[model samples]
Target: MKIQVLFFGITTDLVGSSTLELNIVDVATVADFKKSLKEKYHQLENLNSYAIAVNESYAADNLLLKESDVVAVIPPVSGG
Candidate 1:
């Protein structure tokens, strides 16, 4: 399956791109995608927490991903 990935905040800095096209095994879950990303982007492993949004909604680790899904990597934000 192929999905479009959008990067925001520090995630774009780590990935060096705001958008990426990724290929994943058929019927994969968000956790699977994260594992693949962690392998390719070692810096991602350093994050204390990671958030994935599928089709504009925050997704869980077990959320299944489809070929047409739009995944976004939303970096953590802090405000005073």
Candidate 2:
């Protein structure tokens, strides 16, 4: 299955792009996707704090990813 993964804030720097289409098999949950990302995109490991959005809204780690799902990594905001 193919899914779209998006990166925001500092996550864009680590993943080096705003988004990418990924081909994965049996991606049941966000945690599973995170593991794949940790291995394929090691830089993401350092970004422990990020929100995952399925299609557009924020979702839980146990949420499943569909073939046409759009997952975006939303990093927390920081400012004075």
TM-score of each: 0.95, 0.90
On the 0 to 100 scale, the lDDT of residue 24 in model 1 is: 92
Best lDDT goes to which candidate?
1
Positional deviation of residue 18's Cα in model 2 after best superposition, in angstroms: 1.0
lDDT tens readout by residue for model 1, 1-80? 89999999998999899999998999899999999998999988778887999999999999999887999999899989
**lDDT tens per residue, model 2, 26-64:** 656998888888799899778758888888888999888
Q: After superposition, how far is residue 73 of candidate 2 from its true place, in Å?
A: 0.5
Instruction: Report model 1's TM-score to 2 decimal places.
Output: 0.95
User: Candidate 1 vs. truth: CA RMSD?
Assistant: 0.8
C-alpha lDDT score of every prediction, in listed order: 0.92, 0.85
Off by over 4 Å in 1: none
lDDT of 2 at 36: 89
